[model samples]
Target: MFINMASPERPVSNGKRDMEIDKYGFTGGDQYTFPGVPGELPAETVRKRETKWLVMLDNWNIWMAKRFPQLKKRCRKGIPSSLRGRAWQLLCGSRPLEAQSNQSFQDLVSSTIPETATEDIEKDLHRQFPFHEMFCQRGGAGQQDLRDVLHAYVAYNPKDGYCQGQAPVAAVLLMHMPAKDAFWCMTAILTYYISGYYSQGLEVIQVDGLIMQSLLRKVCPLAHKHMEKLNISPMLYCTEWFMCIFARTLPWPSVLRLWDMFFCEGVKVLFRCGLVLLRASLGNVASLPIIPDTYETMEKLRKLDKNDMHPEFLMHAIITLRITENDLENEHRLQMKITKKKGNSSVKLVKRVYRYAPTLQHHGIVQKTGATKHLSSVSVDSSQVAKQTQATLPQKDKLHNDAVTLTVYRPISQSSITTLSSSHTSNQQSEGPNKDFQLKNDVDQAKGTYL
Candidate 1:
């Protein structure tokens, strides 16, 4: 007997099914949609760029050392999507950290983390790029990967634990690369580029917000006046923009482009982009009618027109703005001074802990433990150098213990080598057999010689 079984009708209401999905998997016809405009570079241009980028990747250390300006120019143009993951890793100096780390990503992910962080991460997994195919499905690979990366970060950096904003940033990174690479890139960013931003007090971000306001006052006085008149503090609007690194706020193409420059140039790109956004939204007289009050102003900021955010337009705007690193540094110093005068002890501690030095870690001078130490290239006085070398020697072979004075020879130029040799010979002859030690010639062509 055939049963009259009927399948339940699928509910339909919105135009979701008709929405266009872009090549990158973002759904169109809504706020989450990728821009419909042709914002990407031409195919030919992209191929050329990819070739150049591959060459740059091969000589990354050399390019970073000698041809930084050219490298910066290319990065500002945009990294090709295929190579972006590796480019970002190189730009932020994460690849070395990954190699140097004592604990692996798997180790961190398998280890236990705080229940609070785990719960928070679980809650936010589906929310990051929910419209995108990768993360759209519950318990999918994307969501699982996102969960693992965030969980590992909490285990890796217990001090910061996990911030809600980091999920989206990690989600973006995971979209480009594997969870392991994403974790290290996220570590470099959190450790150096925007340290203290996600710490308990959110103090560094607060200082940056103040810096943003000061920048706006100079770059777009009209916008600054409007915001100040309405008493719309930057923290009210910019916290999410800065915190998520604009992963949530900007169009996908613009986000990628901004990040390209950001990794190459450091956090100043963020400030420049923020200034551009503020000027676009609130600086114009025409914008005032649309964004009259704080609520409307915030709405405008949150839901910026995609056309304005298209990479070509947005990047052009960001580039035209003449803000410099010095400007950002000056503003940061000014804001911190004001904060210090206010006697906010907690904020003061934040300043001390997260003092802004964007390049400190990128050059490998700062370690994962948050300690600041000098690299081999840093110069030391002869006395200190002697003391260090003496400390390394065996106690029984210690010159200090024998009451014999030791001379530490500095690296000398090739032209001065002969003079130093002659002086050493004369000293040996004058001091007789007691000074018969042979001089070691270790020539470091770049810096000098060490004996």
Candidate 2:
């Protein structure tokens, strides 16, 4: 499946016969090239890393449970390319989610989805990584798989449906694995990692822009002042960077390297990268020459210097940044408070969307009665209810003594919660505050670890 860059019959031309492609399948063109584009790792180093990754993959549960920090460290270094797809699935806990689902990828793809979603997905197919061999052809296998993955996702989460930004993200996943696995990995990403970014109002991303601005003010005051003076919003420069997960923003090598850390470390990596880019472009006095005007500044942000963006240098800079998960969370809370004070309706919607945390139970994927439908619920560990809620009964009426209640159960091996059928029995009450606290902790842990 490798691109043959040295083939003589396929002349190196700017036309359709262009044979020059990079190891990552980037076409030979100035647009894809950058100064100091990193070279491939040495054979021995790659081999050693791959071997270590194989061992880690073999004992994934143990590593995730007891040696998570060590695993995070290795992920920051970089994942071996050959094992990256599997590593991503394991890292995000997508495999178990995929396995526990009642619906198969085929079923999802075949089921009915919105026509608008399908049309939007179709339009974006050829646009994503079109220069790469995998998706170069208009109606090729790559495009077809991209279609299925997007279609299935639309079917799976119809509320958010499809966004143009997701095409590039899914296309990148397809480059690493099959459509099914890519779908689940994308599911984990959209459901947990960057949940609200693509929703209708895009409230979360808007709040994040403010958070990034706040971080910039602390970390790089000069850049912050410069942007403020120019009347430039963070969203003006960073929307594509955050929305596409940098797929279209960074060079190919740096994009992959960033994703390696991003999937493991969660969305903080994005904030760090954004801060670094701001600092690199405008923090110093010398940067004035490159960005003398608003237009030039926007251009500079879009097309960063190749040497600065080299995978090794970019990753080093990202690692050195002082931002942390707690920083992001704290800043997010501050932004939300400010937004709430302003009476922004979107903030209320964001709060509601995040309250339940978008687990399997929130999606109604698992049922109480243990009945299954196409892409429906699976009953696992029938004895343990993960969540329960009961309506208060009116004391005056004996007929209204039976309270309506809802119960959700947890799977034995995975972290998702499932819902139970409503019961009108008088004794069907919530599991009390202690059990509710424990269930919330479990859901929080699942969200935190996966992200």
Q: Over 4 Å off in model 2, which ranges?
A: 1-17, 29-39, 344-349, 352-451
Candidate 1 residue-wise lDDT, 297-342, digit = tens? 8778877877778788888888777765445544555665555555
Model 2's alpha-carbon lDDT is 0.64
* Residue 313's lDDT in candidate 2: 78
Estimate every model's Cα lDDT from 0 to 1: 0.65, 0.64
Which residue window of length 10 is worst by lDDT in model 1?
422-431
Per-residue error at 25 for model 2, in Å?
1.8
Candidate 2 lDDT over residue span 198-253, tens digit each: 88767677777777887787778798877777777666766677888887767777
**What is the clash count for each candidate, in the order shown?**
1, 2
Residue 436's lDDT in candidate 1: 26
